[model samples]
Target chain A: MALFFRLEEAVSDLIHDGDSVAMEGFTHLIPFAAGHEIIRQRLRNLTLIRMTPDLIYDQLIGAGCARKLIFSWGGNPGVGSLHRLRDAVERGWPNPIEIEEHSHAAMANAYAAGASNLPCAVFRGYEGVDLAQLNPNIRTVTCPFTGERLACVPAIRPDVAVIHARRADREGNVLLEGIVGVQKEAVLSAKRSLVTVEEVVDNFGPRSPNAVILPKWTVSAISVVPGGARPSYAHGYYSRDNSFYVKWDEVSKSRESFLEWLRLEVTA
Target chain B: MSYTSSEMMTVAAARALRNDDVCFVGIGLPSAACNVARLTHAPDLTLIYESGTIATRPAILPLSIGDGELCETALTTVSVPEMFRYWLQGGRITLGFLGGAQIDRYGNLNSTVIGDYAKPKVRLPGAGGATEIASQCGRTFVVMQQSARTFVEKLDFLTTLGHGRTGRERRELGIRTAGPQLVVTDLCMLQPEQDTCEFIVTSLHPGVTREQVQQNTGWPVRFADTVAQTAGPTADELAVLRELNERTARAHRSDS
Candidate 1:
């Protein structure tokens, strides 16, 4: 059964040191609050996973909470570069985090494979591409029926998956409307899943046609954290704070300011 | 309203779109061009984002793929897998626009890194959906500001394979798309040589000289026999562009 817990308590109980954690959001509904809670709790050496890692992952890497990152794309969207992530990769400022990269299709498929309890995902990709040579995990498998060679990546069964959604019912049925990415697959693939919602409602009466509902049995825990996906938007709740992304470019440029802002805003 | 050459480039790019084309739009300038086309000429144009929003008709310019306006205004949304498998790989998208850190004379793009693969001096954002977009779309358009640095003789890494590798090689590799057809840059327009498949200067923007275009390109740029002056932005185009910008600002204000 899904249980409700306070933000800090949930983080303490669910996330541990050195866990492979997948925090997914396409562009909106990023679980910034949960990421902050993980940082505040001072967890260390976690392997963070996502498709397009943006502000929160940079914060986690800056805080030295991550040892590895499994991702498809990592950048501050619209902005140029993720300075903190660059610093970690180049100078090993806080710590040198290892990276295992994949394309968006491969990552999505790997998550699906994990959700389906499969060992690996076979897809048509990485043909004549250098990305395959760099990552050994992306190998080739010949189709038994057609004699076609396809790409294979191991299923990403993470220890924990965390995501933010628009709302959830008291019975723990989560409703994710608008631009649903691989969150559902990430949740089903993980051993434990934490969902931070904008609100906890008695019933998820109506939503947009594109909404995805994660039934109670699939979810491990739920926490109601308003403004959880700040900087990123929630549908019908608030708009994306575009200025924050521009501001983050300046904030994360140098080590001093990044840590200073981190202490004042996140850990504080 | 008087328009700058940059705006001219945007308008010209927008004008190239057909009425019913399904375009996979990139983040920045491509989004602007595609939206302008939708709002003005290409009313039935379908805008797809890699984030899975299909046929999105955003009132405002989306800052990112996950912008709320895109989700709110989309015809429908699907999962990432379905978007890639059913729409992209299934050959449903008609056009795609690409922007990258570096582009070669052959139209191959590099967005991965500025230096070596292992230890890059400048690590660019890795490919999101550009690889698939370039490979799968019926035709692709590249929009960027061209310079010696960007229009390089050789890409640092080939993130999206264009015509540089040749049609025969692409066919052997099972890449079916026609690759990049037109490259609309700040200064001029380029199309691939029919035989060699290298991008050649087709039309230079008004007031831009062939020497200037060649100087900006890193390689020895080839020009068409009859290089023509690209038409400047029309009065209607300028008006539409301005109205679009104003509406985007208004929408941003309303959202805030």
Candidate 2:
């Protein structure tokens, strides 16, 4: 009843070149460590989708693993800015960078729609604007109840979704304490989902049933990696390394420096 | 009676803010208003953010605009399309709260450029979603500390459309959102006239003077015929806001 794979093996097998991949983790917690390793292996032309990306995406792009990036913003707070990605976009680098001008809610909703097998989720949030024109995939659908027009966002089902969690059972049942907004939806919407955990519990009985964010039914692979989000922060386990964030800002000022930093942090 | 400029700006923004409004909050002043609303009057008020979070209810003040805490604590998350199409363009968001590097008399915002579009005196943070949010929101609330440099005669570039070319022209362009409802500064609260989009002082914070405000403005600032005094921040409000900031600092420090 247990499915297990090495972090590197699972990511390499699950994610092929040019695959549409969505990695879970916000600014700090639960980043896809194993996915980053796979990306380091030089898998070319991968398209990444997230609400907002960070150092992981920057490293991928710098390594030539990424072809296109879909997100709103990518940077560390105050320090460690988003110079690599910004320079790439401003310089008209060969990569196709698509900018989503809305809030993170839109990205999560797209996955929710995909998981529920709905064509689109009607949202009455943004009404009369040119935001629709920015992204070719979105359109307007009339609300059935009020007969008012609402935005119909297309489903985003990625080929692979790699997530990091606090704890997991051998069977890949995850327990994500604190914040768990779109974690479930992201897992359910992907064809294959991989979870990296701080610790692998001996049995399912150890974790509170209510705290289990993603059950074994959805996870294809589980790897136990202590001190995940190493450069970043993992709540309750480790604090964020401020030095790294500060260093990122300095490195991000130029592409050459950024690539060198990534090589040290990711490849080394 | 003495308060920091940040506190004055935050209190004014909170008092002027209404319930059930979708606010495109920036970091400092917008964050204060949004959090104060959550603590005081509008607990259920939906916050549609540019970071793609709709109805975000952060337990503490976010470290930055793109803090994962916003998405983690949000009621539901959506894509950029839904944020713009459903909430912003759908005419559901009643108010858009913003701050900027430069603002003009006509209420135009310039967060993208400083000197010129191509070449700039000082390259500011590029227009993230403020441009779209300003143009599309039902109404916008601008909060900034009073300064001549920030309150400019004319913006270097039009990042967000305020009244458009002309006040009447906004309606003709099918801009459903009324645009730039209120501007909250450290010294005063200003509202644009319906016809001209010219700001008139509606209220002055306690101890601030008309001459002081005028001196800080880049152009000849107008004033309402009957201006009122700004409400001061309560002890409880200050405590809550401080607690939020403390927690955020701790979180950042711990993580760092």
Candidate 3:
């Protein structure tokens, strides 16, 4: 009753060409390495959604794997520069990337609604802003009881959700010990889910019941990939290479250099 | 008299910040400056970030503004719109910390294009929430290394306008934000004159001459009649910053 595989194999089967995939992790933590490998396979026209896209997203976009992306910010880690995504937007490459400029929580709420089989969620956060003008997908719906106009964000049920965690068992019981945000909702909202962890235990005996971030029932495939959040530091595996990030920013300034760098760092 | 570029920038930023100011802090330089203020002077400063964190107080410097570190220690986390509309546009925010690819004399920023908007020679990172923050915040503090290429006479494209045309024109247009209040660089700190949008040297770091500041600027940089000496970072300030970085690196290492 347990499904297990390597990182690459797990992602290869979970993702398909043109599938809408939601990835967990922000900036540089717990990004699905197996999911990245799936992108390296040249899965074309794929739609990727994240709270914020970083180097991995840029690589996917550059590789022609991603046709569209939805996120709040896409850029080099610290410098707050997002040249790759900007160029694609300006040149109108890979079709116009639909941008949903909302907070990470708002996007998670939309996914939560989808997981709960709801049409939309009324959020009070976006009351008076031009974010409505940017997305156009979100609409104003009147609350039945209060008669107050609230922004109704549509559900986002991605075809696949790929997440990387600290530890897991053969049966896909995941333990994410630190900050737990929208990872649970992301797994539930997706039709199928893949979990890649730093280590795989024989069973879920070592972890306390409360420490389990995702239970086995929600996960379809599990992969044990040591150092899974490569380029991005795994929380306890290694310190983030600040020097590497600085170098990446310098190289990513130019389009040609960035493409070559990605091909080498990500694909190989 | 000696300070790292990051430390010097932080000192300049800390001095520029006012009490009860709401600041949209970018990562790196902005984070250092804001945290320094929190530690020393501006304890009531409200920090709003694009990551939806409000009034963040990280014990150490965050790896990035969007890192869970910010959210974990933040006083409150709201949706992105509330940060922009209610806090920013509603004029609750007083200052914005910005770093840019290029800046013009009028304080117009160019994070978008290098040549033209239609067919840009180099397409820079398109404006994120910076456009809104610059336009709506009560005042914006720009931090960049002083250089001719960055301090252009006119920007390739207006990614964020500090003053629509000029200080006079900005007033005429009824712009809400007071526009770019101060420009802090590694060499010196510059401020826009009251009636004109032209930047004048307000303070120079030790060993940085007025001529050096002017030479580095792209426009006809003016100097204040009485330019003051920029205070160097104290031993305590430098120690705290280094300790923060070391702790953050250690935390990441242990977690990995």
Candidate 4:
């Protein structure tokens, strides 16, 4: 069974230094509040993983929380580059960070493999692309029966998985709607999981067509955090603050402004 | 109708789409092109986003791939794993649409890094879905604003395969998807040569000279035997595109 706790308590209890953390959300239901809490706690040397490392990961990277980033794409969505991520990789602003890159198909399959308790993921990927040659994790496996060569990558089993969602019942069965990315597979792949939800309801009365429910037994803990996915937005709850995404381009341009953001918005 | 050259480029990209093409839309220019195609001529076009929104018809442009607008308007949404496995790799997409920072003569893309991968000048957002899209889709369309920097002689790193140094590389490797078949730039439309697999200028936009195309291209670009002048965007296309963009701008600005 999953227990409900405060955001800070959950972050403190679930995350620790040097942990391999996976905060998986596509663009919707990103756990911005939980990320800020992790930063506020000043965790370090963490291996952060996500497919698209958007603003939340950028903030964590800027605040010097991550020692490495494993991601497919690391941009500001429709906007441009993540300056903080660039600083860590290019200039090593707070600290030098290691990076492991993969394609979307490879990462998704790897996560699913992790969820299935498999050693590695196999798929037809990166046939002639140089990305497979560059990364050691991306290799080939020959089919014994058909004599076909397929691409394979190690599973992504993280130490902790964090995500935001629409609602969680009193029994701690979480409900996710709208653009559900790899959160379920990520949670299943991790050793422990923490979910931040818009509300904790008595029961999920009626569900949407594309609703995904993670049973309580699968989750470690939950936190009630309304508007937790601010700037990113939650489906059917609040509108996406698209302007903040646009404004973050300027705010995260320089280290000084990023620090100001930390002092005022994050740690304040 | 009077339109910016970029608007002409977008229209050209949209015009390339047929009613039956199931386009896997990327973020920026490709998104604009596919949406324009859906809003204008190719109303039956099936648009799939990386976030697993299949056949999404958004009224306003989404700032991110997983924006609620996309999910709300989509015919159905699936998990990311299913999207790549059953839909994309399963051969549902007919055309893969893309935009990138740099391109080679073979249409090979480099959106990963600008300089050395280890020690870089600028680190770009690495390939998201382009790699699989390039490999899985039946054909690919590239939309971009052209310049010598983007149309490079060599890429710093090849993130996705278009055609290898020798075009027979894919055939040799037993990969059969037709890679980046069409490229639409602000100045011209390029199609790969049947023999060389090198994209050569096939049609130039109105008032854009061959000298201009050659000057902007990094390589010694080749022109097709009968290079044609592309028709400018019609008033209806321009009006519809402008309305869509304006509504998008208003929504993002006001909602923020």
DockQ for each numbered candidate: 0.60, 0.20, 0.15, 0.88
lDDT digits (tens) for residues B1-256 of candidate 2? 3567688778768866677666777665688778887777777777766545778888776655546677677776654444555666566677788877777786777665456433335434444556557766777889877799999887776656677545554666545667888898889999988668888899998888999999999989998889999878777777777787787677767655
Among these predicted structures, which one has the highest DockQ? 4
Candidate 4 — what's its lDDT?
0.93
Instruction: Give the candidate number with the greatest TM-score.
Output: 4
Report the candidate with higher lDDT, 2 versus 4: 4
The digit string of per-residue lDDT tens for model 1 on B106-207 reads: 788888888887778887888888877888889999999989999998788888878745534566787777989999998999998888888999999988
What Cα-based lDDT does every candidate model obtain? 0.87, 0.69, 0.70, 0.93
Cα error, residue A137 of model 3, in Å, equals 8.0
Kindly indicate the candidate among 3 and 4 with the higher DockQ.
Answer: 4
lDDT-wise, the better of 2 and 3 is: 3
Worst 10 residues of 1 chain A by lDDT: A203-212
Instruction: Output DockQ, candidate 4.
Output: 0.88
Better candidate number, 1 or 4, judged by TM-score: 4
| Pairs in steric clash, model 4 | none
RMSD of 1: 1.7
Angstrom error at residue A133, model 3: 10
Error of 4 at B180 (Å): 1.0
TM-score of chain A of each: 0.97, 0.90, 0.90, 0.97
Ordered list by lDDT, greatest first? 4, 1, 3, 2
**Docking band of candidate 1:** medium
Per-residue alpha-carbon lDDT of model 4 for A1-268, expressed as tens digits?
3389998989999999999999988898899999999999999999999999999999999999999999999999999999999999999988988999999999999999999999999998888877788889999999999999999999999999999999999999999777889999999999999999999889999767656889999999899999999988888889889899999999999999999988999898
